[model samples]
Target: MLTPDRIDSEASALTGAVRELARRTHFPVSFGGFVDGGNAHISAIHGSRTRSLDGLNVRVMRGLGGRVMAEIRPRATPDYGAARHITHDYDRHILGEGISTLLAVPVIVGGRVRGLLYGGAWASANVGEVVMKPAFQVADALATELRVRDEVERRLATLDGATAPASGALGPASPRAQGGAATPTEPHPSLPAAHREELRESYAELRTIAAAITDPDVRARLAHVEQRLAALSGDDDTAQLTSSVSLSPRETDVLACAAIGATNAQIAAQLSLREGTVKAYLSSAMAKLDASTRHAAVTKARRSGLLP
Candidate 1:
């Protein structure tokens, strides 16, 4: 249930996680880097002496980390100076780290390489399963976290595209009338078909991410996002055009919580009410809005401008 800010905070925590992994696995040095365009930018480093690799850019397929990006998997080298397979473009930087073994694991999310997790050792040791296994696990967890972040970004974009227009625009106005005027077509009163489809796809992805989240608090946060998206997709003629939908204060409060995917128990705890009371309020709101489900009620409420 982390907000955008919290999600970012969690992503940044990968650096610390990398440091811990390096220490635990007998690798004295570790760093985390992210890919941007055609280059990898080193963002976090620990146990480096020269600082040469700090903030350095490794071109795609040109170095150890670069090869990882190209292959979209984990790679390692027992001797950086003697590795003949990878290009030696980063030899200077790698040598500067004073490590004999190096390992790089690509952070793949949603089918694209997003970043890298790296580990290195000061002694001459082979970077085998012992080192690579833990690094890969870290990379896998990071990929899921990155996927959540990616979904959040896409969700925001979808919302912006669907909501950015004249207030109550509701597609086109149709025409006029048939007398001597023009005939009016039915107004959409919701997002355009293309935009709606985009939102639906984004919503589905968010749900997938939510289901993948193991943290209860984080999962709840994602659930709330799903509810908001569901509310955005609700459409109605009376609610959109005339704004006749109405609910009591308690009803509105309960519906707002439900809109964010809050369960009845959670809503009760948040509102300091009994579970039965929360359910009663939700039922009243749904009845008033003529909605068959909690999600429908939220959508109807939002279309009527009753909730943001």
Candidate 2:
């Protein structure tokens, strides 16, 4: 779960990513914003000659990033000073930064626009596909990071709520008392079994998304969540380190898909395999776990800390 410290870390990590994008793409300036209260809050900037854009709040469809967010697609202009398609709400900031051209990419998570990434050039120039590809890649990575953070925050909220006293009642057992660990608090012993199942499902979703993600940075962050989920599930350090629980890679992939409630056909379509192949893999996974049904297989995998 994301504490204040973890939030700071996420912000710092995102800032670094923005800076690296600017440096690698050879853009004179780069900036990024996260969606907050339906507004794009400028959170990270790099290579800016002026502070006009610092902490800018771009309303949806009011500026470049906002337009991208509203459209849920990348947009670019060779000449920001004369672009006729966009609202010029931030022209002053653009001119102040000496940027004549810019590109904006929407950061989408779960099919919703969650943030935006921007790259700027001082001279009027076309932001070609070569540059646009990397810009969109950065946006995708940021979107994944934001999703991971949100999941962490949700988990933390659950834990906090569970530990809170009810009408002056006492909290759950401490980490040291419950699991003999001084750090990395384990899941509360009194938490209901249903809630644990939910956590495992969330963990499995994270793993499936991580497996599908192509961005290295996003995958790394998701890996951390996987480890945390293992700990929360009472899986030991050795299991976390080994991680696979003797499941073959294909078996793991099949079970990961099943864990997310994907049908055999849907999984086949996703993995570009025949439905029979999907069924065979799932059957193999079930046999390996000695389970008789798909749900049972998922349950066994989660209990073994293999799905998450």
Candidate 3:
């Protein structure tokens, strides 16, 4: 279930994306919002001249943004009022802001339309690749973040219902409960095999998400969650093994992808690293774990509580 905090965070993310769109494309007006029910509520705006766009609720199939939402692709018009391809449901707001050219992009995630982003100018102008490219990039980045958050929330919900530490705490307490330290180990026996697999997948996804995030606070929060996941999958007997082993963040990321059976090339693409770089990281991780192969490295890392 979506909580108030989650909704606020989503809005903040959209607002930041809108600000970035305006900055990168130099659009005179940029705004966007998430779709709730059937309307795209315009909750974020930048560079707007007037209050005409405030509180605008764009309905699907009714206007350019709406059509973008319906089509799940970008749409633009050089002359908003004279454009014959789209309906005039939003002319009062669009024209009221003196916008002559408009571009709209859909925020698609998991093959579904999650939100809409828009950029516009007061003078009629062509919307070409130069403008579209950065707009698309911002939208895609936002979509990726949203997808990560969704996965994290879903997995956390499952974990909340699954077994927790005896102290009833689900965070750092789990690690200390094992042996007064933080370690990664084999999956807890009480958790079913399917749940353990799900936890591993979530941990891998979190690592990927952490790699792309630039905000220190967000990264810290994700790291905390990653630690909780690691603690939950630990084995009591191997809790002391982690003191002798330490893996860099990149090494751990590479191993997390490896844990999910991803090939070196796949890990490279996912981590935005060269294949050679991926190999080097893998080799180093294997050496540090004192393993002869990638598979053995992953196993040893898990047994030493270095991985979950």
Candidate 4:
């Protein structure tokens, strides 16, 4: 396994991502950290004060971390003590820090909880608005990155003595043409108007495959390709999108929750929406993006700046 330093670095990227997500939100720039048995603990104690801690225990399947590890789902507590079914085991430490609300979303990759990104509100019913929404965004990105990293590690685990057709990426393609200054090339040519439409469909599908990929290198490369195609083919500009692609506030909720790998049932629960209503929102977003699949719809919306 790679050192905790590498893992932490990968996880820390979520900080900037979350911060940006919450910038216009109701959150006032809170901080979060993932603690384990080893190394110094982060996710500093902050409510009225920010205190750094060392040597905090994060046992598997206990407290917020434990439940996330067990359920592999994002958990939210609007009023920690007031909420039912919550074990306030961490209340002494957390309440001392002046936290009133908490949200912990698990970073589950390959069917295991690698770590958690958690935060709380000292005094805000809007914690669900400012904190939880962005928390879900960060969690989704974390899930994507960790899942990709795990897949890369698994594929790399095989050696010359082993025989499996390398289940993931082929690694960096000829870096010179890409890494160096070079002119772009033309896409395949000589197709009818309908054929061009089909190519657009194909490109969208390729982008979905790229984002759906569970390997960081491959996903990154595929995203690059998708971006290039979107730029050249005029598919990426949100300004150029049909009005149908634009999502309303409620529809955005559906798409954002979906981005975090939330199922209809789970999204309905989280959004306090009916299951049928959730599906309706998803279907609407899909129609706006002209996507045949949920993944493609998400990739399109994300690329087009419709969803952060």
**Relative to the true structure, how large is the alpha-carbon lDDT of every model?**
0.69, 0.72, 0.84, 0.53
Task: Give the per-residue lDDT of model 1 (tens digit) for 159-180.
Answer: 7656555654533552211112
lDDT of 2 by residue, 1-308 (tens): 33676667667766876886797678989988767789988899998988988767888888777788788899999899889899998888887888988988888889988777789989999888899888777777677677766775676466445434355333356542332322332333344566656666766666656656665655666666556554555433322222234777567767877876889998777676789988998898888888899998877775665654
Q: What residue runs in model 4 are displaced by over 4 Å at the alpha carbon? A: 3-5, 17-25, 29-48, 52-56, 82-84, 124-131, 158-308
Q: What are the per-residue Cα lDDT tens digits for candidate 4 across 204-297?
A: 4443344345545556644544343333332322333323355775676667567646789987776667899989988988887888988888
Give the TM-score ranking, best first. Answer: 3, 2, 1, 4
**Top lDDT: which candidate number?**
3
Residue 141, model 2, lDDT: 66
For model 3, how big is the CA root-mean-square deviation?
A: 3.6
Off by over 4 Å in 3: 164-189, 215-218, 235-244, 292-296
The candidate that wins on TM-score is 3
C-alpha root-mean-square deviation, each candidate: 9.9, 6.4, 3.6, 13.1
Clashing pairs in 1: 1-217, 1-218, 1-221, 177-182, 224-260
lDDT of 3 by residue, 1-308 (tens): 68887787788889899999999999989999988898999999999999999989999898998898888999999999999888998899999999999999999998878999999999999999999999999999899878877866776677666645555544554545543334333335466667777778888888988998885545766886787677666444444364487899999999999998999999999999999999999999999988999998988887776777
TM-score for each candidate, following the candidate numbering: 0.61, 0.64, 0.85, 0.45
Clashes (N, CA, C under 3 Å) per candidate: 5, 0, 2, 2
